[model samples]
Target: MIRCDAHMHTRFSEDSDASVHSMLDAAIERGMEAVCITDHLDKDFPQTPDFPAGAFLFDLGNYFQRLTQLKEEYQKKLEVRIGVEIGLQPHLGEYYKELTEKYPFDFVIGSVHLIHGQDPYYRGFFEGRSDEEAYHEAFEVTIENLKKINSFDSLGHLDYVVRYGTHQAEEYSYRKYADEIDEILKHLISHGKGLEMNMAGMKYGLGFPNPHPDVIRRYRELGGEIVTIGADAHRPEHVAFDFDKAGEILISCGFSYYAEFKGRKPIFKRIVP
Candidate 1:
């Protein structure tokens, strides 16, 4: 089993109400070896009716203080790693670099939650364009952001746009976007970055994880080795959700290990057969 759930959010993130203690308790109950609290840090996030200005931002001072205390309290039971999930935009490269360096984060997850200054989560993003076009645009923007951001351990939920796409995964497949996806995989591999296998795709009823099993296989075939398992959970119950299936998917995808991070470096652990 993939014992370390490398991605999760707590009350530190504006979107979640689950406390850090609640999440850690859930991880312990599930018998996980480690969990990373990668709260959101999307600078200059576009404001919407439901999300206002600074909605994706958090107070780093308070976050670090509370987590530092909890990390030690739980050290004997479960490993708690400090992390942040940064929303990648071309303009925020240097900003994120400075923020990452200023803090002592154990891991960082770089994700593209917006495309062209608009969030794909809303139905409006898919309007005036075909689903295929919108999906392609997301991948294109992801490539652009990847080129700009360099202070991340793994790319989170590589096909995140698909979760909100109209018709969702019905019109999505790695083969459909091989040219762009291949370039993305190659870029990550060449940069010593890792891909995240997020289980939240299943929670969203996609029937498969983000990037799909085919993408994972293709990543391996391209000589990419580092992959991390994450539930992308915002609630206690969702912590490590569908992790068993995650292990099966990793094994089937030709991965013998999953990655965990400490002090911004990867530590691979074997997946027992």
Candidate 2:
């Protein structure tokens, strides 16, 4: 079983209302070994009706202060690690590098949440293009951002755009974008970065995890070994959502172990059968 949920959020994330204490308690109740509080740090997030200017930003001082105390408070019953999920944009590479260096993070997830200054969560991002065009552009931009940044431990959700697509994975596949997708996988592998198998795909009703089972298998086939499991949970109940299936998926993909992080380095834990 995958007991370590490497990605989660709380009120500090700006998008979540769940407090840090509630989230840790829920993880302990479920017998989780470790949970990383990877709140959002999406600089320059575009303002929207639901998400106004700086909606995804948070105060780092308060975040670490609270989490540091809780990390000690929960040390006996559970392991709470400090982490951050950074939204990657090509121009923000240096800014993220400095931010990451200044903080004592146990893990960092580099993700692509915006494409061309527009979030795909909004309909405006897809208004003038076919789903294929939109998806292609997202991947292209992901490649650009990945090429520019190297401060994160894992890439958050390789196919995050599919979650907001018109059909939402009905027409998505690794084979469809094999060339671009392979480039992404190869880059991560060559750089020693990991890929996150975000279970939020199932939570979002995509019928599969982000990047799909095929992509996970392909990553292994190409000699990529680091894969982190996460629920991307924003609330207490969502912690480790669908994680039982996470081990099964990793096993089927030829991964005998999943990754956990401490001090920004990956530790491989065996997946018990």
Candidate 3:
């Protein structure tokens, strides 16, 4: 089996505490074959009460230098890919593409963590926005960003807004949202991109799997072949959280293969059912 944590963060990311070395050490102990240090790269919304006003943004200069050194040091032990998890915001479109072009990252995971300029990490990001509006904005922002930045390798968590929305899956399944979701999935497939199976939802008490398994199956049905599974793990214990479940979900979704990345290209491995 291939053991990889494609969505890991280090101290370079505002939300994480572990250093790259410490994370690599822990992954090594657990026999991880590959891991990517995907720190957040959100330029706007840099003001967090805990971290200073300018603290939430990524400083590409030092981040690239440090990741370059670590990749060399760990090359003998495991394949290390340098990456970033960019927050897909509409206004910052050009800036993100410029950053990617300037950096030497091997993989890029674009995400929609903020809706209408506020984050779910804060208490009132959704106070004024209706749940429908929030969900709609989430989809709109994702499509807008994808259209602007085709440099990314994959899209993160298709239905992540459900995690914080007022409405749960009580009425809509991923299947029910097929018209919209299929449009997104087809876009990914057409552009030679993929979606990530973010297992973090389960750990966060979202009550369902990430991207919802039903969506995973639909992606398969729509010729969406590439998928990279991640815990979105911020700490050691969560490195492979629900990965077994992730594999099972893929199998049930009719996926005979799962993927890993190196040098910005996906490498698929057959899933033994």
Candidate 2: where is the Cα deviation over 4 Å?
Answer: none
lDDT of 3 by residue, 97-204 (tens): 788888878789988877767676665766887766666677777777777777678888888888877665544576556667777888999999978988888886
Please give, for residues 75-176, the per-residue lDDT of candidate 2 as tens digits. 999999999999999999999999999999999999999999998978888899878888899999999999999989999999999988988886788999
Query: Over 4 Å off in model 3, which ranges?
Result: 46-54
Please report how far candidate 3 places residue 22 from its true position, in Å: 2.3
TM-score of each: 0.98, 0.98, 0.91
Error of 1 at 242 (Å): 0.3
Query: Model 2, residue 6: displacement in angstroms?
Result: 0.6
In candidate 2 the C-alpha lDDT for residue 209 amounts to 88
Candidate 1: TM-score? 0.98
In terms of lDDT, model 3 sits at 0.79
Off-target runs (Cα >4 Å) in candidate 1 are: none
Better of 2 and 3 by lDDT: 2
